[model samples]
Target: MSALRTTGLRAATGVAASALALAAFAVAPASAADTTQASVQGQSQQTAAKTQQAKKQRVFKVRTEKQLRMAVRKANKTSGKDRIVLLRSIKFATGKNSKGGAGRGDLDVRGSLVVMGRGKSINAKGVDRVFDVRTGSRLVIKRLRLRNGAPAETESGGLIRSRGDVQVRKSSLLESTVTGAGASGGAVMNDGGMLRIVESRVRRNSSERAGGGIEASGGTTVIARSRLTGNTTGAVPGNGGALHLTGTGSVKVKGSLVANNTAGAEGGGLWNSATGDFTVERTTIRDNTAAGAEADQGGGGLYNDGGVLTVRASNIETNSATGAAGSGGGVLNNLGTLALSTTEVQGNSAPRAGGGIEANGGTTTVVASTIEGNSTGAAPGNGGGLHLTGAGKVTVDTTKVLANTAVEGGGLWNAAAGTMTITGSTISGNTASGAAADQGGGGVYSDGTTSITSTTIDANKATGAAGSGGGALNNLGSLAISGSAITNNAANRAGGGIEANVGSTKVMLTTLQGNNAGTAPGNGGGLHLTGAGKVEVGQSKVHDNTAVEGGGLWNSATGTMTVTDTHLRGNVATGAAADQGGGAIYDDGGALTVSGSTIENNKATGAAGSGGGVLSLGGTLELNGTNLNGNSAPRAGGAIEVNAGTADLADVNAVDNATGAAPGNGGALHITGAGTVTWANGRIAGNSATNEGGGLWNSATGTLTATGITFEANTAPEGPDAYNDGGVMTVNGAVILPGSGI
Candidate 1:
């Protein structure tokens, strides 16, 4: 039991008066008063008598390493638990040629051994095990320095190996080297035992195989308020520069700094691989690296395989991996369950994948943490900050993924049938560049199923030589986007804002605004859906978006688009000799329905363009309570142009539309196909044209009907010689108007 725990127990036991007195005695410094001096004199006389009796019984102090070892061996051989072995400031010299040759020099302690430094140092040379404790012994090392001054090639085992419980408090382990063909802990190694280390420092340590600083296998180790830094693994394929844990062990680390540690293979700072559980709280893992030749593996800061790794209130930053296929510059979770809360992973770089975290065949959950400013360099990486692959499940709640860059997915990349759910989080300002000919996603690329709810996807850029979409979020599987905003995203090619390909996706109650798809020969400005997928957008707004063909939304072949209560407005298409059509919306070969929407103030200006507001090439458009107004087209259909499609307009209004052309015809609506255009209980008024047909121009043998509506104040060219027509009636419209036209 710890003294702090004992104090807490005594305080909890209702000895309040005695506990308060002890607290006052422990807190206040001893002062000399006349009455207190008399009481202190009386206590000093009793303490002198007890000291004389204690000196007469047995007072043995071991000062040398050989003397300390002999005393511990004698205590283990002769005495029981009642004996006390005292080691005070014992200098143990350890090297290849010092004291004796490197063998197992064990000091087994069966009784209680108190190795006290008393603000002094202890040097050990060529000592394999400074102290070994049996199952019933209690070894306490306080305020001691176990220094191992050996060459890099020599083999030095742990300073202390304990099978029983070991308590190391306020100690420092320095200048230790575990050479080639040997695994050494600079301070101690606990196998099937319990080790408690508090306020200790483990520095300048090197190991050949594993655990350069401390190795604990099949034990329970608790390290609090300690520092493990400047440790390295010297041999090839070595791991765990600062600490290593294997077997069925459990380790808890709190308020410690694990930094500047280097490993040859994996886990530059800490590694846990064997059926154990590691819990790290309020710890900092930074500035660590793993550099070698053959298969230098994951986690520049920490790596865990087949373990339960839980980290809370920690910081993992400025770590790196330098192998060919290095993963998880900060943390790597392979077949482990890693749960992190209130942690920060920033400024980490990986050569291969997952600059911040890489999880393969594991479960990772991050809540209220931040994974930002991480980068993966010129490699075929998947995710810049987080990579979730191999059937892993990643859940992020209220976390932030920002300013991370990768080749495939800038913020988060999910492949190989993994599941990622981001709720109330943000994925912003991430960049992805294509290496050769492949396109990358700016914010997120999900090759599997991904769900995002109540999140924000903004300001992400995907740029390269063959870069198509700057803000391209490519989805190959099921993508469900609800209650989110995708705004200010840029792309170089088609589907600038978003491209949903070969997926079953739905965007509901979302907003897509102010996105620019760069000048490329493609369609779908705000969103493009293709490859036999289905997209349903409900109660959303897609406005102020621009593309070459489709300004607000563009639908390609083979998809179902159902939009309700949406708005598509203030979009422009500008390109030289561009096939600029559908300033607000364009549907190529899909089933599109626009109901209760306002698609207005859109311009599609080009040499021979059409459909300033909406263009439906080959789809079924059912418009209900929609307003398509103030739209301008240079060629035809100031508000809408339909070719090879059926448009059913009910309770719709197409007003204040203009068409500018040498031989302008359609002002509000144009139907030039074998399609049917029916206007039931609607109005097409205040529309202007340069030539004729202020309301509509139906030319390609289509049926046009207007019932229970008015075409009032619609003006053509104002002159008898200017071919002005259709003040109240346009071309071939059956109107039932009760009032006269203006």
Candidate 2:
């Protein structure tokens, strides 16, 4: 029995082992199936969650106007952020509005919503605005074209009226208008909202008042990579044809364009009355116009009134202010602060003043900028490049003012109440063509207090009958020029380089070279002083100047001139008349003084020229420690001449003086017409005359007094040392050296 039981147990054990193996193989297949079922169930749950989230997101696709209205109403009812996607272009009719609600008039937005247009268009049919955002709502518009929207007769913003935060991206606003007596913002009006425009265009918009394209009040407006063009204001008086801001918020334009806009009053492109900052960077303002005829209406490009305006790396070009009394064709700072850096203002025109920029009663600063190719209109036009008037402080540093034209002040004009400082600048290729007697300044005109340092005024012309100061003119003010060069300037009348009239002018360490004055009959090639002014030149050089009367300097009856440590060289006087020649100086009824100065290589070449070095006609001429060398004249006075005046010489040297004409007299000194010449401790050497006195000549109405005088190497046909033709002569301690016959 034990043996049978053992056999059964062995069989059972074997069977149990086979069963366990079968169970293991089956368990693998069952677990694989269960894992597959669990994965499938998880995927189903995920799909259902995603579907529920999408339903809560609230996305609407609209094709017709009714669908769009329903989508907007549903978006307003939704809690979270909603999106309305436009499937096709939609046109809105002239619908009636019971009140300003969400589902009706203008598609009012009352919640955070995004309207995506997918390159489609929305037409308003010239009836009402396209969008009106409520106070607390947030609206975002993208890839849409909004056109032909006309707001109500009493409202602004034909396209959008936002009182909340709004953003527009890659969109266009075109042919929108607002028509009322005081309506504004033909395209968009942001009232106490944050308006952000990116890569959008606003074009061909019109408004009855201001802001033909955009108006922002008490909000922040930012435009980036956008364009505003072909906008127009009403025919009445308004400001800002493209953009107007009058609020306490800031406005910023970056990498944008504002062009081809027109205004009836001021600021054809942009007007900032915000009291906050208005900043422009890397933008362009071009081909804008202001058509007002009033004195306070101007600024074809930009106007800043009681605001802060900062422009950097921008261009303001081809703008016009076509009013009878308008100014600032490019930019106007009226009672505000303006700063321009690394910008260009070119090809601008104005009727009254400030063709490129105007600063009136404000602080203005320009650094590393170029103001070029600007012009002003006829007769009373002034300040082609920059005009500073009405009590302001202006600073121009490292700037170029070039190729400007005007009646007066071709480059810059500073009025009597303005204070200007120019440093490291260039004023070149400017022209002033006014025929009036009180107009001229090819480079600059200053009736205010002006200071110029390390500047160059070159290649300027004053091509008028009575124009003066080819380089600069200062009248009724104080002008100080230091370390500057005034070269290659031409004037039709007086002062080819500078004119100081009824003012106080000081020039120190400056150069006046290659200047020409008086194509017909004028004087003062380098410097002219008139109208009871005081002019002081110290440590300066005047060379290569040509004029009819005074090649180097001319001082009028009431002018006072003082020259100290200055050099006058290579000056020519081409007058043919007997009393109209002074190669170095012509002092006619003035107080002229030259101390420690050098006058050399001056020539008076004509038939009846006189005074190659110095001429005094009814004035007081004083020369102390001065040298006159290589001076020649055609007739009378190669070095010094006194015709109806008094000349006093102390420690003066007259060397190598010659009279080249036939019957010439006075190689070193000439006195005639009731004049007096006094010499004390002076030397006259190597003087030659063609006919009469080689060292001294006294006429019948002249008087000559000499004390301690040395005469050496004088040659003439008669009286090599001294000649008196029935005149009074008193010589004391006269040392006549060899090669002279007295």
Candidate 3:
């Protein structure tokens, strides 16, 4: 009091003296002590003392609950260089009767707050959120346990709620529940901003509407190397129990594990609607299930509707959906583009169609993926491995379609008006059993136009009590096979290798061998052509196949067959007997033409039967430069037997063949109809019989010609018996032999 009073009095007196001096110097009148000047001098002195005190830098420690809150708030509003509020081992609690209540307490900070302790628990008695960030503020939550803050049933509580950008890295959000009617993001919610979570664990989080673990509406979200496990929604059953992204939001998940996430509807792992782009790379979607109490639910691992789904180097296994008609046990693509590369879709089963992958109205490109051991259980569905029903183009290249079972097209079934092109792939070991009388196509069944090139259709079996053909493939429409192999396939009734009936089917350079058309009463062991069916074989091999009549090929009454430069050898027709010949070839009631070909070493080993090498009944036999040799028959015509047909042989040879019973009764060539036999420039030599006419026996009122013909070394066992005539020439013909011998 003594020093302060003296300084005030001295300072006032000095100001008065200076004013009087200025009055005297300028010859002015004195003014009433200049009271405004004296008052300004006192204020200036007091402001100087306060500025000196503030520069001392005070250190305020926060130990009590109220002091900690005031320190955090003071640091938030300050704008200095190092505005930091330090809190060490402080115990804070919000009471139930407080102003903001226990549930409404938060440590709001706009600046830095260093909280250093391990056993510190800030209990907000019952609040909706522990930390809330306002707009245009950045929040970095690091190494903090942001758990349930309240026990109030009315308000849903979570760890962090932000309207701006929130980055939570190396943090754990545990045991938090959001329990409101339209509440989402039980643990963390990013309303309309970007959220990045890396190396974090989000577990035991619950939501009511959607996104039990984390939900992002219309922003970019990135989750990398995080574990989202055992998260759930409330009683209403939410979608994407781990992560639900909707409303045009894009999410890029890399190297994350989303396991044990359950939903009431679609997308047990991740659900995407509203045209969102979701990319999952090197991730695992496992042990997730969708109950599907809602309508039209799908995707046990991922449910994508009208979005782009790219699964690369990922494993989507052991996921299930229990809806009424759920599809795609691994993935369901309804109206989007699905591109899968180097992925495994295995051990999946569907109730409707496409056990591994189902595409209804989208374009699916599968490259270098394995679709194996999948099934559609007795649902009258198609394509156990993949089903394409709607009108879309599916291109499958270098994919393994193995061990898949279906009701139709065991490996692939394409119905409706869709187009499926399969090249350089194998469709093997697949099965299709029909319910009623017709189960067609064991490996692949197409009701549309299917063009198969350079593929193998092998080891497939179709078993129907009334099934017709094609153990490996069945086509009710147009089917073109070029440079493909259809071998080692068996059917129940007919067309053991391939059944092409009543359709515009063309097979070129396709080998049909080792095919059996069962033991039933149909034709065509290698191929069955009937009902205005046309088959043309050029430079193809149809050998070692078995059927009733046409062993190598079965042609019905209305079936037309043209074979050029083709070999039909070692085919058998063991119906009741071998009398129905054509071991090498059989021509039913149709027009047959053999030109520039050979039908040899075929046997009709039936008793008193004919037509061993070539059998032509009720059809025209035109042989031009054709050789029918080394064929044997117990009856007549070892090389050829023509009944009710015309035999036109030009430069043809029938040699080293045996036929008939006795002398003059059996010959190498026997013509028994009102047919004309013309041998222009060929040899019928070395043909033997027990009777006469070792070369030929024409007895059914037919005209024979032997111009430029030679018959030599033909032996009749009962020779010189007067009936044995013309070893050089025995003919009921206008015989004109240039050179001949006996």
Candidate 4:
């Protein structure tokens, strides 16, 4: 029995040993650039004669500085050989090439070599590069600390320079420096060669121009599970404090971090102009800065000027671009296709525009992302979160844009030539504060065709007196919204929810509620329209909005507006304007048509105010199968007031409306100035006036014509039903008057 137990225990021990061996060196695949870290393979099971793929893996162990020099010389002499140099717990302060010839610092390899350190370090105290790989050679570094290099030129790659393939794993490169015009890559430089870094760290590198940490050109670059920290470039005109990838090489970075990087010009974290695709996945780039402080310099986190750039599951936060006219603190994509998924861009600031992202002349798509807490460092800029310009198409899906502040388009400012769309997203808590008017769209400012589907725009603001405020959306182009909600938005001037200027807006199956246009006296609480624009709302709700005038909707356009099967209710209009106050809707120009809709529970709460439910100043207004009820006006027209305009009400109900104070008239309907009202097949009942004209009141020069109308149960002292004060009243069908009794 004892012998059998011993055999079982031995079998279990063998399985355990195998598991440990696999777990120790199970390295993930390397990504492209910026993410590579140094990783060490588990100590080789055998020392000198270990077999790999049935080949003799020549290995050399160096325990002293002299031995290291000899080994490098031999490897270079035997050019095309595969060799591994192991540092057997040794430390070296190396300098110059083996032949004391060309190249920088320590050692030069003309053949492929793997330099593995057994918990050792190498420093090139005042030299250029610690190691340089020749064109036909390759260098692999594992478990090493390589630091203290000061290169004379950027191409020297302060610590390591490679003209061939280079792989670094489980290593650290620190305190490298480069000081020269257009010089960069303090830690490492890959010159038209492939570079891979895994499980390593590159920190405290300084450069004069770009790529304080790493620079890759032409060849493929992959970085995985690494960190590039505290890298700085260019006290003058730097770019890419952490990484720079140019030429035709592909760059891929995964599971990495680039933080606390600083650039004097652009791209504080990374700059890629590869023309051969760039990708970053599961990475974080935070606390970076670009300090040009001049016009047209930006990209605090990343700058992609060429190639297709894709970022997945990344976080870019707390970055700043301080150029006088700089843009894109988080990412600046210039003439490149940018695709992002599951990314968060937050707390980034630019002096001018695009605090989170700026896409210039390219197509961009963001899916399941978040862009929030971004702001312009200076005033008078657009697109605090995102800026799309020069014919770029931007599509956002399942994204959230929140708490971004700018002078215009706090969440997003889109002037792209192609259409922009937001599907199943949330845009909220954004603000646009400017000294000028019409420079605000707290949530989004779109100057092109924009489609919003299944999105929510709420709690945004555009603050400025005389400012054109679209608390939720400002559309100067074509806008289409479906299955969306715009609510709890505020503006200090106008347009609490939306503002359309010289644009067309279509709202379908959307809800617009609890919006405020102005805290004081302003116009258009829920929406503001002007400048030859068209608006249409169908199967939607516009309710509980507060404004100084036109509480629910204000249209002063030369185009047309139509609302069908929508509800406009619970709105309040309180201000100083006598003829401009409208609790539910105010129309100054453009044709307006309302059918199968309801306007109710609206109030005009100021002295000399008019139109508790609706007010029309000019243009043709038509109402069909609509209901206007439970409205209160302090001045006149508890339900509707018209001035110098045309109105047609057919099959509509005006009931439960009242005048709030004395000297008020027209509890249900009032027409003044050059206005004309024609009613057909409608009921005006259960209305009360404080002074006179319980049902209908027409001032001199006004006209009221009614047909198939029923007016009853209206209470007033002077006129119980209808009063015409020197105005034209032509009744073609059964009209009930106070004294006429029928």
lDDT of 3 by residue, 1-742 (tens): 0011111122334767565333221111112223333344545766645444333222233334565555455445543211212233333356432334222265553543333223333434344455555455555545545566432343332666666667766667766767667677767777767778877778877777667788777677888888888777654646777777768878877788878776666676777665788888888877776656332455667777667777777777766655667666567666777787777777666666666676766777777777777666556656767777677667666777777766766677665567777766666676666533245566666666666767777766566654445444445566677777777776666676777665556677778787776665545677776566666666677767776655666655565666666665666544434336555555665666666766666555555556656666666666778776776666656677665556677888877777645222344666555546666777777777656446665543554555666777777654211122222223434442322222
Task: Give one digit per residue, the lDDT tens place, for model 1 in 1-742.
Answer: 0122222223444577556434321211112232344355546676655544332222134445555555455445433222222335555544433332212254566766666665566665654446666776677777877776443343443566678888888988787766657665655667678888889998888777777788787789898999999988855557778888878899999999999998877888888874989989999999998653222267888888778889999999999877888888888887789998999999988888888888876899999999999888666776888988688899989999899988878888876589988899888898888633236677877778888889888888677554434454556687788899888877666566677776776778988888776665545667767567777777888888887777778776577777788888888665323235888887776777888888889988766667889877767777889998899878767888776667778898888987778356578876655656666877788888776666766653555565666677777753211121222222224432212122
Model 4 poorest 10 in a row by lDDT: 1-10
Q: Report the lDDT of model 3 for residue 348.
A: 66
Give per-residue CA lDDT, model 4, range 1-742, as digits (tens). 0011111122334767655433222111112111211232454556212223213223455555555656676557543344544544434454432336222245777887788875577776755567878897888899888888775553548888888889999999999887778677879888888899999999999888778898786688898999999998876558888988867878898999999998888888988784858899999999988876653468899888756889999999999888888788999887788898999999999988889998776888989999999998554588899988778888989999999989888898878365788999999999888645566788988888889999999998888564555555545688888999999988877788887776788889998898888754467787788678888989999999988888988887485888899999999888655786789988876788889999999988888888999988877899999999999898889999887789999998989898867468889988877789898988989998987788888777777888887887999876766777666776665443423312
Let me know the TM-score candidate 3 reaches against the reference structure: 0.66
Best by lDDT: 2
Error of 2 at 548 (Å): 0.7
- For each candidate, what is the lDDT? 0.72, 0.85, 0.61, 0.79
> Per lDDT, what order, best first?
2, 4, 1, 3
- lDDT of candidate 4 at residue 515, scale 0 to 100: 87
* Lowest lDDT 10-residue stretch of candidate 1: 719-728
Give TM-scores for every candidate, taking all chains together and pairing residue i with residue i.
0.83, 0.90, 0.66, 0.88
lDDT of 1: 0.72
lDDT, residue 42, candidate 3: 46
The deviation in Å at residue 323 for candidate 3 is 3.2
Per-residue accuracy of model 2 over 297-358 as CA lDDT, tens digit each: 68999988879999999999999888898888999888899999999999998888889998
